[model samples]
Target: MARPVTNAAFEALLKAAGYGNAHAAFARQLNHAGRGHGTWRYDAASVYWWLRGRRPAEHVQATMTDVIGRKLGRPVAAAELGFTIAQVPATISYPTSAGHAFGAAEQLWAMLAKQLTPASSETFQSDVALQAALAWRYDLPDETVSRSRRQPVTAGDIQSLYALADHFTNLDRRHGGGSPRARALMADFLVRQLAPMLHGTYTDAVGRELMRAAATLSGQFAFMSYDAGDHRIAQHHLTIALRLAKAADDRLYGAHLLANLATQAVYLGHAQEATRLAEAAIDGAGRVPAGVRARLYTTAASAYGRLGEGRACQSALAKAERALDRATPDAGPRWVNYFSPAHFAGTALKCLSDLHLYRRALRHAPDAITLAGQNARTRALHTALIATTHARAGDIDTACGWGRELARHVADVHSARVNHRVRELTAALTPHQAMPQVNELLLALAATPPPE
Candidate 1:
């Protein structure tokens, strides 16, 4: 075999961080940073391997960057340590101008719809998401989104975009984000109809409204991509949505996008980055509406739970509950409509489940199920959560019963996220396969088809 390439940059950074070839010292810092999550147990040997170009997992790399940055009293990006991130397409980069951003978004939609390249197998990178959040938080607001073109846009045209956004949102809620009809319809509308409208002439006020509408549509596409397991595509679309929100000068909406990114991070197991993004949204959102505040805090609680910080997790959950109590049903923006009591309970169940508070988690199940209303995806996920909690609590028969219910729900939905939860349930119950009901549930789950 050929020799592994050396990571000279990483070695140099280690010295700059005052480790000075003391690999064990650096490893100790990493272990400290990763304490609550699980065992890092890294030693000099691990650092030596990394320097010899055995790249660590994405989450470990993120932790390494954090440890080194703290040591050197500066921000250290993954790139600075000789880690190569997957190249982001040019169209996915931060926007330089209103027209440029719109054009880039159009091209991105085409790329996503056409599948010009194979989907990436790489996991989500926390650093990339964090950097995008920071950019949105600090970047100067656009002076004007006004543009002159052959076609002129009107207020009525902007309203139509909003209507289309609502239509797509409803379709996604009913059919799930992995629905082929929803994906195709959204792509077609964005490319053939919305793209030209974005390029059309409009006043500054109209332009901002248009950008806001675009942001909403882009966010919907992001969630759809996420549900279909196209994580890289989801991150790209989410970043674009954040930029559009910035261009519209809507700080609360920008915070909302950051919260979404945090949720994605937590789903992908990047607990540290999720916490940072959630806190950034909460801190930067100067006196947000109660619903928005509740969402951000709930996101933080989920991240904290993932990290096994039960105390911090419970504190955040309490804050979210208080904020929810203060929120009126129709008070916040259109996006905040999703942050109802049922939705809050669902997230709380997830946080509590992660911390192994299984009984507490199950107590929220009824509210989550009954109040989920018409959202098939939410109902399926919460069902899976309930089943998984039972399995983890050593109640195989009860777990199997819930598993059968999940199997029924899974059959009707086409979501990778729901499928993933089913897989987790399967893993938890596999050892109980001697039981007939558990075996039957496993067979059912095994036969479930991949989402289109």
Candidate 2:
């Protein structure tokens, strides 16, 4: 009864789609975004929260949607949500595993709509009702995976694998998450280099680490499929990522695997399942370091916010903050890297924003802006959020002025999310026709239709 969507049920849905996450082919889609590796890596934990439920500032939300849509095919609004409760199966995880989180796909889309520039009612993500947001992380491969490769994996193969992973990582990050060209390179590496390497002999530790890197990159490739709206293929990539996780024997990172699964669940509208996975991330995070733990809990709080459990959301938010506090500014894993105090504040402000705690959101806005000072994209994002809050509070002049500034600053950043947020702000200002500056801002937006 607690299960809003069954684990096996999603597997069946994925199976029916003619794609599974296990195939390495999905990684090939990353070329679609034409992004470099530097653009793909983010404050993964904060993005996790946004993926789960917290409503980030408008610009960030738009950028996220742009980035994801560039990878997935259809645009994903920041407001979209799909989470669960009682997520982890004691069968594979501990019996008492803390699973079960917040809302589902509806929340994700809603957050996205909130970030949109042209506000017609249809653009609102809140109107979207996600029914399959949560699903099982360990989706099965119906047919035989044909794991038998012709050659064996050797130490040299691992070096090559790391090099390939690093190469793509840099490429995707600089460009966007959906770098199909880079993804193809990885796919080739998988077929020729990795497949041969896996066959060669290596220690269990080496194999696990190698698989872990492969799994992570495969999931990154899944982003490309998702951008193309090829859920069939995207599902396949997610599956491969999970299997790689198991091969690696890193349960904590496996929890990260579940977190991604939870993201898909929310997109599918499986709130219950999404929540469950989020809770599992938190539970498994206990053994991780402070920064990593913060990442897990922050993601959990996002799920909690989606579930509409205000207290739970706040509690999780507090925990996330504490975890952030526990970490020295310099301490964090390179894989889930790029989180800082500023990043944490931006994330937490988003949680409050999702809860409609506008005052808190506004208060944190500047602090987030300050923290994001080093990041032009992020600073622009926070600036837009504060402007939106001002607009929401009926301060049109303040809103218009900030909106104009955002547009000006976005002049240099090539982020779709930034553009979307700036546009959405224009849409929101439409209601204030009487305000001259609002109209001016609108006219300016109308004149350009795209940032200079």
Candidate 3:
């Protein structure tokens, strides 16, 4: 009889145990586990679809479980490895203890690192969001106590982790999240490097800083996942990221995570939830720092615009602008350094564009492009937005001109949202689809693949 392979759960467990993309390693483990029985003959590629949520027979599940259990130095259950078709509990709520929060963060990291199919946005219960928000508002997690571990974590290790996160963020901004290699590279680092440190021994101070860094990177991962068109996966990461931020007592970063969650909510078409998250972000952030306050207000404006709440959107945008006026050097968390005058202008442009105030939005387009320095992806997105705004204004020539320019840079970054904007530009220009310029732009978009 042929050796049966179990399901995607097995693959996830294998990856979590560091067997991902290492066929030889997995083969060796499989051979060792099945040695007492008939030899199991298979190459790594044969199990590829197993990672895509397929399940194998019972014998296969048992064999794989043995291999994984032996490697993990404990007995493993088929259900634990994802062999069973049980519903995985959502870990979206805030935790009452630091340990619980960190554990949730670790599980979220594993799911992301393994690239598991995420729960659907429909599964995002509002009560979960409300519970998380209320918990964050009314209570803080207990302080992290010293943990017993094989290795003692140092401050230098924490700094290195922060530097690693910075490197990924820079790449994402310059190249785009759809880059062929960026997300996987970051995931590998999260699993192989940062995850270990989270389990290592650390002083309370070091642990706090480490959690903050982890939270920032997790949020970045969520955004990258979002840009790649994995909305549910992005939400899962953001929920866990917020928990980590809260556990660290990093109020500024927590607010930033909330804004990120709001942005995701807007993208998922949950306008009410988006507005709620954005408002909660602002209210929970007591004595907000200058840059972070602007970001939060800007996100609120975005949510409001999505809901066609022009008055509310403008009010939030005005507050964001006022917050910007009070900006000082590096006033917020280091992660929010990109929140600048240009960012404000770009966000305002989005709000106005959503509200059909194209002429007003167009006024800020030039500043957005000029000041979006070193961020090729942002430039591409803003350029596409400018093109769309022109299309909406009935200026086909200018729209197509910008669209043509955008086409040249489309292949440079890996962002689904950027591609979506270009597609929206195409739709906005549909009335003139018969035009040569319109046909040309359409062809350009056709050649662009969906983000991975």
Candidate 4:
């Protein structure tokens, strides 16, 4: 038998929020708030879906919270409005201190390693993300915890963990995050090598450093999970990473984590949320190096472009350029090292491309291609963008040329995100398949090996 609709919670919430007819109120609020992305049909009938326990999109949930909170003259959380925190796994709870955060992360990693927890299908939970962002913005859990351990920890062990984190990050960047085998290997290392170190004692200073390293590793795990299309698991890991970063008092890295979440928002097509998250990232990023600021600005620019805010996007791009100009070779940390001249150009190209400014995008493409260096995955992305611009401009020959160039690296780069661009290039050429070059491009893409 089908489960009956549960309207009690929503009905009560609506009553508390002072809405007489929720059907009309929801439609009016959503329209006024500009929550719909041209496709959301927010009308009286749509409210029925919520009453039936059918969840809306992440942005709608956020907008609903905002709208109701305004009417109630207070901050309204999603939980009070009947939205469960789906991003949090059953294995862990919110942590309050560095030691607590580290312990929770270790427990979760062990569960994942042992397959004690089932994989979740929930993708994006805006409420959870919002809570995390707010926590990161407001709470800097700097509580001092004694690092006395069963066995004394050494600097060598900490160095080793850092090296492992760096290695995995580079591997993910080069080969993409879709490899189950790679994820398993990293998890095993975390369980066997890093977990014990966290439990063993050290001084307060060393404990903070250890937490920071673990945060980096955890953030990488989260990103890999995201790249592999495991959004729920990614959210769990990301939450853990943010807490650990706060515990360690690493503001710059905390900003990076927010930017990572913002990137996921953009990828998931939540332009408004992406913009908000990116803004939060910038706000929390205090006194960072110019390179780091540039990177954050790049994220904001991407979000603005997605929203079709040309002026805002251009302003952000300008800020990124100025920041890049101010950056010195030895200025930023290793995490921000990837934001090189090529990276700067690539980000600007993407912003332009997202805004449908192909003329500007094409002008910037060659420089990005030239400086993309040995990063085949990045090169493939830049090449595909060039192909897309030509295709959009009705220049079939030029488009096919760039497509052929992109296909050369498509098979070599094991990144699904990059492959998405390749797919876009192929789609752009679909109408011209009668041309020999276009047909060849399609065949090449079709024959490319699946991500391992």
Query: lDDT of each model, Cα atoms only?
Result: 0.80, 0.51, 0.74, 0.75
In candidate 1, position 5 carries an lDDT of 41
Alpha carbon lDDT of residue 118, candidate 4?
35
lDDT of 3 by residue, 1-452 (tens): 44355465566777777786685577567756765644344335334435544344344557778877877788888778664342335555656676565555545544444454533443455567667777766784646656555457788988887888888888888777665367766765675467556766778888888788888888888888777776666766777777778768887788888888788778767888989989999998988778888889999999999888999999999999999899887776777778878788888898898899989888888777775567888888888889999999888999999988888777777787887888799889888989987988888877875444
lDDT of 4 at 334: 79
Tens digits of lDDT, candidate 4, 1-452 = 54455766766767788764666666667656853433233455445545655444444566778887887899877666674332235443346666556556655564455342333443577667777888888975677644653345677778888899989987876777767778777875675467656656677788778878888999999988877777777777787888888877888998989888888878778778888988999999978899999999989998898888999999999998899899987788778887777777887888888888888877777678875355667788788888888898788899888888877777666665776787788888898899888898889878877755
Q: Which portions of model 3 miss their true places by more than 4 Å?
A: 1-91, 114-125, 449-452
- lDDT (tens digit, per residue) of candidate 2 on 92-200: 1111110111121112222322221121121112111111112223333123212232233555656666676666655544443333444445554443334324333
The model with the greater TM-score, 3 or 4, is 3
> Residue 323 lDDT in model 1?
97
lDDT per residue as tens, model 1, 65-133: 999999899999878889544233633455655555665676566444433234445378677788888
Top-lDDT candidate index: 1
Query: What lDDT is reached at residue 450 by model 3?
Result: 49
Which candidate number has the best TM-score? 3
What lDDT score is found at residue 95 in candidate 3?
A: 65
Cα lDDT over the full model 4: 0.75
Q: What C-alpha RMSD separates each model from the true structure? A: 17.7, 15.4, 9.0, 16.9
Per-candidate clash tally: 0, 100, 2, 3
RMSD of 3: 9.0
List TM-score per model, in order: 0.78, 0.59, 0.78, 0.76
